[model samples]
Target: MKTTERVEQAFKRIKELLTLVTDWTKQPKEEDALTKEFREKKLQLIEDLYKQLGELNDRFMFTHESEFKTKEYVVQYDALKKKIHDLEK
Candidate 1:
């Protein structure tokens, strides 16, 4: 895959992990038998996504920080994150 594609995938995975966490948050009120398992799985996914995000950040650092130094990058990143957050709800 291309570098941009890989970055997008990492973002997508992080979004998925965030969604799982959000779901877990809403489960505290319920006394369901599956709650513990759900929490565990969400936590694991969050951890894995964190590691992947770190790697992606490292790659971004090594490769073109210059490309992301502009206002456009800020705008795009914020917009992407907002989309992710919206998905979580």
Candidate 2:
């Protein structure tokens, strides 16, 4: 895919995953009571987040051309990175 498309896809996925993480975080849980199901879901989300981060990093690594440095793509990449950071926390 083109750089813009790749960034857009990553940004979209990050937003979707952020919603999932936010919902998961808002659930009520007992003190230090990490249930098996909750642990499993959290682990899965972390894994998915890491995968997305790696893909975004890889795409940016090879994308040094000025053509791909449009204002829109830069904004999308920044948003994607920020969302990934939030999800990580």
Candidate 3:
């Protein structure tokens, strides 16, 4: 796939995972077991997507510095990490 397509896919996956987490958070206390399970799965999916995004960013960095700057990727990755960390808490 093209670089743009790959980036778009990664973003789409991130958005989906975020939505799942948000939905899981909105559940009531009665289904704590199911909610916790869903949250754990969502967190795992987020981590996997974050790793894929990092790998794609690295590839982009190697191929096109002008289009995909490393510093911007680093900032975005750090922000993502912070968001994930907050979710874990």
* Top lDDT prediction, candidate number: 3
> What are the TM-scores, per candidate, against the unseen true structure?
0.38, 0.40, 0.43
User: Each candidate: what lDDT?
Assistant: 0.67, 0.74, 0.81
Model 1, residue 37: what's the lDDT? 82
Best by TM-score: 3
Alpha-carbon deviation at 7 in model 1, angstroms: 69
- Candidate 2, residues 1-89, lDDT tens digits: the string is 89999999999999999999999889666545467777777768767767776776666667875645557466766776776677567
The local distance difference test score of model 1 is: 0.67
Sort by lDDT, top down from the best: 3, 2, 1
Record all residue pairs in model 2 with backbone atoms less than 3 Å apart, i.e. clashing.
Answer: none
Tens-digit lDDT track for model 1 on 44-83? 6656655655655565567776755646555655665555
Error of 3 at 51 (Å): 2.4
Candidate 3 deviation (Cα RMSD): 23.0
lDDT of 3 by residue, 1-89 (tens): 99999999999999999999999888564767877799889889788867867786777668767887878778877777777677677
